[model samples]
Structure formats: C-alpha cells, structure tokens
Target chain A: MTAPAAPQTAPSPAAAPAGAPAVIRAIHLSKVYELGAQQVRALDDVSLEIGKGEYVAIMGPSGSGKSTLMNVLGCLDVPSSGEYWLRGQEVSKLSEDELAEIRNREIGFVFQTFHLLARQTALRNVELPLVYGAVRADERRARALELLRQVGLEKRADHKPNELSGGERQRVAIARALVNRPALLLADEPTGNLDSRTGKEILELLDRLHGEGHTILLVTHDPEVGRRAARTVRVRDGRIESDAPNR
Target chain B: MIALLEGVRIALQAIWGQKLRSALTLLCVIIAILSIIAVVSVLDGMDLYVREEVAGAGANVFTLRRVDELKVLTDLQVFLDSLGNPRITLADWKALRAEMTLAEFVDPLRSRSGDLQAVRDGRSIRNVDLQGRGAEYPGIEDLDLERGRHLTQADIDQRREVLVIGAQVAETLFPGVDPLGQKVRLSGRHYEVVGVFARRSNVLGQDRNIFAILPLSALFAQFGSFRSISVQVKAKSLGDFAAALDEARTIMRVRHGLRPQDPDDFNLTTAEQFLTLWEKISSGIFATLIGVVSITLVVGGIIIMNVMLVSVTERTREVGLRKALGARRGMILFQFLVESVTLTSVGGVVGIVLGFAAAFLIGAFSPLPYSVKPWSIVSALVIVFAVGVFFGLYPASRAARLQPVEALRRE
Candidate 1:
C-alpha cells in the first residue's frame, strides 16, 4: 500500500505566518512495533498535511494505522522514519524536552476514556495543562474556571471524575484539553465510552467547537462520526485507502 | 512559588484521599523521630545539670597527693604505691600546719563507731556515720549549723563528752522536741547533743542528713585508729590556689617521707578534681545513648522513602496526564519531593513537641536532670528535613522520568 496524500486546505490562523504552508505536515511517516520478536508495521510511510481550523476524521478498521498516526501527530511517539513538522517545527527530530514544550503549547489530547484524575475535582483536572505550562496560580485558576464554564460544567466544577456521568466527565476532559488554547485538538474516539445519546451530545459539542473555528482531528471507526468532519481519511493495512472531503 | 503551592495542594488532596494509609505512614515517622529527640534532649539536660553542680562545688581547686589524685587512673599498683606506710598522723598535721603559710586550716579527721540515742519523748535513732574531727573542721569545711554550738577548742582540749547531730538524726531521735543538751548513748557512752546540723543541699545520691561529728582527740579516745584524713584549704585568692596546693604538697612530702627519692602516701581530692571525673563518666553515657537514638531516626527516614515510592507508583496515571498536558520532568520531580519532605517535616515538628513534653514530665517527677536546649530542637528539625530530602530523591526522580505512554498504559 502506498502512503496517503497530504491533507489539502488553506493555512490555519494558529499556524505561524512565516511561510508555513500547513499547520501539520507529515511525509513518509512510518512506525514499526516488535512484540516478542514478531515485527508489525503499524504505520507504513503515511504522509498527510492538516491545515489550521480543519476538522478531519480518520477512520479505519481494527489493527489499522490510525492510532499510530495519531500518536505521531500528538508528539507522544517518534516515527520510526520520516519527517513530521508541527506548526513548521520539525517534531520528528525534536528532543524529549522540546517535544514536551510543543505538546504543552501546540496540541491538546482527548482520550477514549475520560481520563480525568480520579482524586482531583473537575476544575483541577482542567488546570492540569496550565500547570505544565507554568502558568501562575491566579491565572491558572481563572482560566481553568473559564474553560469549565465553556463546557457547561460550572456547577459541577468541584465534583470528581467518579461523581460525574460519562458525558459530563467527557465534557470536563474537553475543557481540560482546551484550557491552554492549544493549536490543535486531537480527539481519539472521544465518545466511545458514552451511551448513544451522550455520544451524540459530545459530537454536537465538537461540531459546535469546529463551527466556532477550532482546528479538530477526530479518529473513529464509525462512519456517522466521520461524516460530521469537514474531511474524512480512510486507512487499512497500515496505509491510507482514500483521502477526500466529506459530503 | 505558585508552582510550589499547587504542588502542596495536590499533595494534601492525595493524602486526604488515602487518609488511613497516610496516617499510618506518618505514625511510623513520628515514632522514629520522637525516640531520637527524647534521648538527645534528656542527655543534653543531664549534661548541663552535672556541669553546673560540679562547677558550683569548685572548679579552681586541685587536689595533690603523693600519687595521681584525680582517680582518672585506678590501678592496684598505683593505689598501693601511692599509699605507703607513712600515714597522715597528728604529728604530721601539726608539722604541716606550722610549716605551710598558704594552708588555711589543717584539720585531722578520724572516724569512730558510737551508738547515739537521743531521748526526747522516749524514741531513739541509730546507725549514723559518727565522724570526728578537730575544732577547725566546721570553719575549714564551712559546715552549716541548724541549731546549738559547734565544737570549741576547750571541748577538744578537755575531751568533753559532746556531739553534733545531723538533721536526719535530729528528726529521728528528738521528733518534735529539740535535741540540744539532751544526752545520747553512743557505744554505751553518754554524750550531750550540743548542736543540730543543717541539711546538705544539691548533693546527688547520698543523704548527708544521717551523720554526727565530734572532736578528733575525743573520737580517738572513744573509738581508735583512722585510716584516711582529708585536708581542706581555702587559698587567699584564685591566683594563689595553685601556689597554696604546691606548698601543702611540699610540707606533706617532707613530714611523711624518708629519703628524697621516696614517694609520699595519701589521696587528696579537691572539688574541682571530683567534678572533672563526674563529667567524663556522664559524657560517655550520653554519647552511647545518642548513637542508639540516631539509628531510629535513620530507620524512620527509610520508611518515609518507601512510602513515597509507593505513592508515586499509585499516581502514575495522574502523572502521565499532567505530563501529556505539558508538565516538565523538573516540575514532576519537584512536586513529589515537596510532598515527601512535607510529610517528614510535619512528623518532625510533632516529635519535637512530644520530646519536650517527655523531658518536662521527667524533670517534674524524677531526679534525672532534664532540660531541653533550644538548639537541640532546631537540630532535630534540620536533621529530619535533611532526611526527607535525602530519602525523597530516588522516588521523585523515578516519577520525573516516567514516560507518558508507559504510565498511561499502566492504568
């Protein structure tokens, strides 16, 4: 299978204006995993470009390269080979510290599992990113409350993850991801753990956020979810099958 | 500062969440620290008391004997060689008293066995150390008299049957009535209780209130041979104390010795010499106790480290989330370190207060000299804090080095 084509769109506002064509540009990105001497190619030379303010959905079957690609894009893993530039900074070759700084300043992640700190209140969970960014206490608290209010969790701000419903917890997670006002919001099956009605609510919230000009990348196996994005990319057997604008 | 405060808030929240486990862990640290502080404070207090008592008794007076006088060296050979056949007799005292100009008083002491019965309203006391000395004994030693007259020259010269009873003896024999001029039977001999001596103060271990004194000549006639004699002297000034000691030594050597090469006999002890010996013994005991206490503190520090390691492991997912959000490894390290240190420091403060309470209780009820030094409290705090930092480093580093992916995977 050949690598996928680069994402096509105009430059995003969050991206640097210093001659950068896209917010994220991946060329021949590949990741290989060795499990007990069994070699598995998770991502086979995937190349893609995602412009600023673009809402893209990545869909694939089980064992497809979507998760690996997401890991690479989020700077949580280094590609086995190839160049990946985040906002014109070559993230593939960045040091661990540099990668951490970029992760703090450029990307926000929403996991399939709400992943809120069980011991912390919703407000504290949202403040986690600002803590990493070394934001002052007064500013961190004020901004965290603002994000909680944005997610309509102001009344439930003091409740812990276990005290909240799946939908509310996910909303708190979303609030946490957007607290630092990151360049991109990367959501991996954000609604996977919720009921259908709660999942619809989450999708509606993401749809609202995208409409409000937030750059979003959604990874899912569901076609209905994919159709909501501005563009959809399909992957199979460690390669992209198609990349096109959604109807 | 904000980061530190955030770290503190997070740590408190985590500890509050696991209340039982955290309290149990803190209990271990508190016991360890308490043990150390208690032992050190008591020892420090005892040392101070010993020094003060010894110094008050005398610090400039040095005893001189034909042999080494301070009891620092105690061998059979030294003792035998030091105490030769030449005893400090009455004639020797007379010669030394006349020859030594710096000698304040040369009082020859002799012990006698005499059963005294002071019949007041029918009760009598027994078994007192009946001591006898010359007329100069009370003046040279500065003995305190509670009532009645001391031994006079006429009493010694005329060999009068008179006596002075210590406070304990007076209380026992006389009860409510005064014992002065009352006749006491001693070794089947009758002697009048001429005076009641005051109770000795600030003395350790022995009761000075169970004794009686008589004139030296009278005691010899009544009982007989004495083995030892102590010569008490007060120098003209502090600067002349050494010179007076030297003069007394020369006179004693001349009166007791045969040839120029022969060593004299007798052990002379001054208040200063006794004080030094007491300090040496007390310091050795204090050092040994401090060593054992320090071991407990070390064990406590190790327990803190172990608990912190467990905490770091339990919070792996939380750490991962923070890291993914943008926390640097240094921030992670700092947060964990602060938590561990805060735990130990709190335990230390509690331990110190507990130590002071223990010391106070001991001082109130027991004769053991217990005083808490301010520096000791400060030292305890500093040492415990250092222990927290030392033990916390490994676990904190482990947390800081955790990979976001691996940590999240653990969850």
Candidate 2:
C-alpha cells in the first residue's frame, strides 16, 4: 500500500462523507477490555472516515471512549472486531511491526503532556522518528530543521524539553509530529496542558497546517477545542453520539 | 550500523543521566578486569623471566648432584630418603672425566653459600656466593667475561690463587680501581682477581651479580676437601646431549658401585628439567589467579545485569516512545546491548591500562620482567564484551518485550 501524501490543496470541502478516498476508514470497529471478571466495551461499532487535508476533532467527556477511538484510528491499538484501513492497507490485521511502520510513515502523534525525551535536545527529538525510519543523518537533520522552523522553534533547537516553556514544548512536539510529513497529524489533547492563550496559538498552528493541505485529527474533551475543526465527532458510552460538519 | 551508532549516543546520554548509579556499576567492572589483566601480565612476565634467567644451564649441558631437587620438592619422603645418600665425591668426578666418551667437557662444581664474605682492604661484601670451578666451567655455562681472561687449565692444575668476581663485587671492592690482578680475601685466604663476570639480571629476588668464582685447586687448598660435588657436563652437540647424559649417569652409577637392581642415588638436572619445573610452578599460580578473577568478573557481571534491569524499568516509557516512533524490537535490543558493551569495554580499557602499569612497576622493582602481548589485550576486550552480552541479554530482552501500549500507559 502506498503512503498517502499530504494533498497540495485543501481537502474536498469538510465532512469527507462515506466511500471517499480516505486517509483512515473504519468499518464497524469495536474494542473490548476485560477488567478481571468484567468486560468493558471501550468502542462499540464506531465507524469514521477521515479524508486527505481534512481537519477533524474527536470529543467526549471522561470515560466516553473518545481516547479509545483515537487510539484505534492512530494504529496504536487494534480493534476487537471489524476492519480499520489506513492509506488503503487493512491495518486491523497488520502485525505489530507492520503497524509500527504505518504509524511511522502514515500517522504522526502529538500528545497532551508533550512527551519529548527529556535528555535529547529539541532538534534530536524532532529527528527521532526519521532516525527509526532509517533516514540518512543529513536528510533527517534538514527535514527536522525545516519542521522546527515551521513551528517557529528553530531558535530553541539546541534546548532540551525542560528548558522550553509549555507553549514552546508543545511547538517542539508539533515539529516532531510533522517532521515525517505524515498523512494524518493525530493530536491527543495537544493543548490540554497549556493556558488559553497558548492553547489558542497551538490551535491556530493546527489551522494553518490544515490550510497547507495536511490532514489533522484532534482528540480533546473541550467543546471549544472541538469547535475549531471543520468537522466534529462526539463519542459517548463507546458509540458515536454525533459526527457532523461544524457551522 | 547507523542505528547502532545512534544507540550508543542514546546510551551515553542515559548513563550520564544517572551518574552515581552508572559509576558504581562501572567500578565493579573495573575491579574485575583489573585483577584479571594484572595477574595475567605478572604471570606472563614471570614465565618469560624464568625461561631466560633461571635456566642457566646451556641446552647441551646437564649437572649431576647428590640429591634431586625435583624429587625432593614433589615428595617430602624423597627429601628424607635422599639425605641418607652418599655424597658425590671428587673421585667419582675424576672417574667420569676419564670414562665419559659422549661428553665434551666435564667440570666439577663446589659451592658454599653461608657467611661467605669477600674483603678488599676495609671494603667487604657479605652474603657473597663462593663457587669452586674447573677450567671447563666457562665452556659448560654461558658465562660472559666483562674484563680480563677466565681461569686457564694451567691455573686450575697449578692451584693458582686466582678468582673471577661478579660485576657487583668488582664495583663494590674496587670502585675507582681496576679489579683485574687485585687481591680479594675469601674463606680466610687472598686470591688475585683474574676476571669480572658481566652484570646479570636478578632471579626471584636473588642477585645474580654478587658471586665470586675460584679455581677448584685453590678452593680446596683454602676450604679442605670437596663434599657433595656437582659435576657439570656438556655434550659435543645437540644430538649428543641425551647420549652424554646417559653415559654420565652410567659412569656415576659404576663409580658408586650401584648394581642394576639398586636405584641410583644421584640426580641429573638439565636445562629442560629446570624449565619444566618452572612451568609447573607458574601454571599453578596462573590457574589459581584465573579462578579468583573469574569469580570477580561474574560478580561484576551480575551487578551490571542488575543495573541494566533498573535502567530498563526506568526507561520503560522512553522505550514505548521509541516503539511508537517505529523502532523495531531488534533495534531496541541492539540499543540496550550497545549500552552494556560500551560500559564494559570502558571498564576493560581502564583495567588494562592499570594492570599494565602495575606489571611494569613490579618488573622495575623486582626480579620479574614485564611482557605486553597484543593478544592478551585483545582477549581481555573480548572477555568483557562476552560478559556484557551474557549479562545484558535478560534486561535488554525485557525492554524489547514490553508492549508499547502498556508501556506508554505507565505513569
């Protein structure tokens, strides 16, 4: 299966709808967790489609299974039943290593806590995925530098995660997420740890990236955060409560 | 290859993050390898020193004495039994000198060790080993002359009061003056120094350059008759050595009137025998030292394993992050292995340097000579690498086996 490149133009409007050329296609996906003698259904028949260059947000309250849906969509976890396709490959049946390759080549993740390796400088953290991807050192450096420049953290390239402020750390994480030019930028509460002003800055960065034809998926509990996306999908009780384009 | 280099970089960073813990772990590795290299170097040095210095007899020469030093050392009962054997008399030496056909030279030796002092005016040297030798002594042994000539046949036959003093005695008794033709008193008699032997290295703390050699006739005139003499015999060629030894043995047995049914009382010592004896002693020391070193390395290896286990646990989330970034299981394992090997190899290098310095100091101050073999250093590195792999396997695999989802979930 070919990697889905970032489109050169904005996605074919919002609400990519069903049966489109999707970056992610989930068909009746379900996930179950056995907590000792009790079985908790984390995802129940959750089907979703994300198209190239589309910016979508997954939102839900605590224990609402939105995190579970993001995990399945990001190839971090496989569903208990049903097929999840990413970039035309049936990823639900892929092996751990194959899934890891997909995650590296097709999806990029920005976490809530900005899980940058504390020991590495900002540039090293951005170059990490490419290092694992077996990219040459010079090329990895050039690409990571470009992404750091794009995130406006080029001046702080040599600084460690602890040396950066919360907003700068999140920008570094964003640079790291986009360094690979992944098909989908998956952000799980990317602004959860930031103040409103810094959070708004991060949201603007994501909006600018969406305008550049990069597909974006934001998972957050904040309705205001969800409202920034062109499309919002609300999850509740292991099921999709609503998935519709924002006004 | 690139991944391994990256792994090394990361490993160094991780190790630097926990300075105290890594230091303690490295200490154990250093001590273990230090002991191994030091002991091996000293043993190797001693082996070479003994081969060159203690085996003083020429390849074609053998000595016949009253009791066998080898048998006495190997068995205490042999020591007691040999005390009862008759002394090798000068008459027996004379007979062997006349009857031996395979021998090229037959020289009689008589040595006295205790309270033997050489005096020149007021300057005196104590604990000087005094030896009585025939004119053939220089031919049977590789004795070098630093000045003047050795004793001639005329000097030995006419009982001339002549001596060949070692370099140490020459330096002490006649510091500014020439020792040749100078009178030195030994055994209550004065003898003119004819020659000075070349300076020699010490053997097992025994100074080789403090002795004095005298003509056999002169020694007897001063100290009475010879008792338990050792006759040094040299064969005509390398091929004749065994034949000459057998002929001398037979001649001594006949002279002592020993029948075929009775065991010979005298001992025959060759250059080869001396080497074999030295080898036996050195090998025993080597084996014992190696045994102790192995235990230390194992303990060190265990410490490394424990430290690695803790490191793996501490970096569980980092491992998850790496996996999430597309690091394969093999890459993870390789990373950890590189870290372990790097740690041990550092310890090994430090140990080798310290051990070599220790050996060098020992050689400088003592009788042993230091030898640095490239293979020994290579083998030491290989050993530490093996230990790292052996101990690092469990913890590295534990890190590799961690599920990325579970690991990322860990707080």
Name the top TM-score candidate: 1
Enumerate residue pairs that collide in model 1: A7-A49, A12-A52, B115-B186, B115-B187
* Alpha-carbon TM-score of each model against the true structure: 0.87, 0.86
lDDT of 1 by residue, B215-312 (tens): 77777777665555544565556787788877877777666654778655665667666566767777788788878878887888788899889999
Clash number for each model? 4, 0
Model 2 TM: 0.86
For candidate 1, the TM-score of chain A alone versus the native chain A is: 0.91
User: Which segments of model 1 are wrong by more than 4 Å?
Assistant: A1-18, A28-46, A59-68, A79-82, A93-95, A221-224, A232-245, B60-86, B109-130, B137-143, B158-162, B183-187, B201-208, B258-268
